[model samples]
Target: MSKSNFIKVIVAGFLITSIVGCGTKNFKKTPLDNYIVENSNEKQFSVILEDMDVDGTFFKTYSHKYRVIKHKEDDTPYEQISDWIEVDKKFFAKHEDNLGMVILEKKGQGKISKVASPPGYGYVGDSRYGEWRTHNGSTFWGFYGRYMFMNQMFGMINRPIYRNDYDTYRGGGYYGSRNYYGPKKGGSSRYGTNSQQTRKEKPNFFRRRASKSGWSSSRSRSGSRSRSTGFGK
Candidate 1:
């Protein structure tokens, strides 16, 4: 190969590499998001935005919970569990409105989606976990006999998963970097904090801390729910 051609090739490669690197740097995941990606070993896992306290730019921290519903590769749905973590301002801006919703979910390590999803939406339509059924011409999602307990765990007894809505969530860019609430109607979604069916799930530390005045979130921390009368009480 000629020296001029080789030089041109190297220059082209360098520019491409630099461009790709810059793009990667633009998409920064919060520590909570990173935790789900690095830790979950099940076939599917997700993170929920439970609550937050933002007192100006100086002290802003959001609390979150995560659960891996599946056990290994099996169809059995594990008992849903969640743990809380604090996030910075950047994470706050990205997921505040979607509080009490799944801000991130992973399917077999393929994609760690940031698009806000409804609670239990991660496992609702997956064929391995549940299936579609029709009742008087209206179709809805129902888990198998063994997984029936999840129906209450996810608060879906009154609100059934309709086929049309489920397909939209799984198919296209329904919300695109925004939280997705089912149905176009004015009413709030069933899972997010905005709805009456579901309440903000927070750990005791923040719950007790919530009542105190002037809180700041300069760093991140994780905690579990406490039996004591905390935030909700």
Candidate 2:
């Protein structure tokens, strides 16, 4: 073939290869994708995953718990507590309101704690400004984020909790607790004093069991219950 004709043929082959490559490219979903799919049924709920280093932000992984406060017209102020899940260097969350109107604040202290109230004694208020009462007439500060609320609602679903001797099982699934993805290296757990670890070391067996027990059907039932409960207590 002539040189010019050969050049044209080569160009055509290159174009075809490029097109095929682009068409067959696979897109890998991140952990954020899984989180969204898990909580997709939540109405008016959204997610924002960002790197803590962006713009000198302080929303670092395990360093802060995000408070999402929703303000509605002629309605009671709604608030939710969000704990960021770190995948690599980015933080992931499932928020309950409009990202713009919501007030995003960090809870005091880098860690989360539990405050139990005495029997017959109600209203355990924290020093924080956002005060709310549970159905049991117990007052507590901070809103329970989507994951946190679900973790509590479903009898401590499948999360890990830290204790005196070592880590133990809890009613709630992993959310803002120290036992979600195991310990991390070079960083302290917000919930406990455990050193760095990985998810493989502490697998979320609850999730595996749920899947084996037909999680799809159970999830549907659980979603209905969650909607009815309305995040109270």
Candidate 3:
């Protein structure tokens, strides 16, 4: 083959490979849109917490009890589990409005405690704030005496329904993940001996800085744990 032709073929191959394989950093799951139709009125969705007991000796998995139901219709939709995964304390400080709604957050190893409420009583005005209250005003999730382990499930219709605000608003929150990634429609702290309210109200150790359309990293350190309590409760 001619040298020019070989170079052109190689460039084309590289472009194709990049286009097909490139994916988001720190994430391994697919987008929710692929499974669920954004605004489909056909199916109903719900999320339940799988109760688990870790006796420090061995960990046994339990079925999820409460569920955050999205749609109540008979038909069931498909959605990504991660789309519903949320990290509470970390999420609220960055996106306060997201409170009372289900959302997802990313955390490093041992940082699973990322899901916690803002101290005592969970919510200030509404007890339902930190706890998961069903659409029917019933206890759904949250309120684990020890460590709470649960999963958020997303649902959508199979029809080719038009996408909604979530799908369009792609990473619109503190986590910089897809806006629809969490509760779409709706949308931590160090430990200490201080009071729950006082501690939760305190500022987070890591502060987000201005971005310049590029990549960056952040780091912070603190001594205590359990300063705030939500999904981790």
| Best model per TM-score | 1
Backbone clash total, candidate 3 = 18
List the candidate 2 regions with Cα displacement exceeding 4 Å: 1-26, 48-77, 88-233
TM-score of 1: 0.64
lDDT-superior candidate, 2 or 3: 2
Worst 10 residues of 2 by lDDT: 115-124
lDDT of 3 by residue, 50-169 (tens): 211111112211111122333224322223222223222222233332222223221221121123221211111223223443444433334233222122221111111122322333
lDDT tens digits by residue: candidate 1, 138-211: 88899888788878666578667788887877675743355677764447665554564444443553465566
Of candidate 1, the 10-residue stretch with the lowest lDDT total is: 224-233
Clashes of 2: 12
Task: Give Cα distance to truth, residue 178, candidate 1, Å.
Answer: 4.9
lDDT of each: 0.60, 0.29, 0.26
Cα lDDT tens digits for candidate 2, 21-43: 89868444444344345444432
Best by lDDT: 1
Superposing every Cα of model 2 onto the true structure, what RMSD results? 17.6
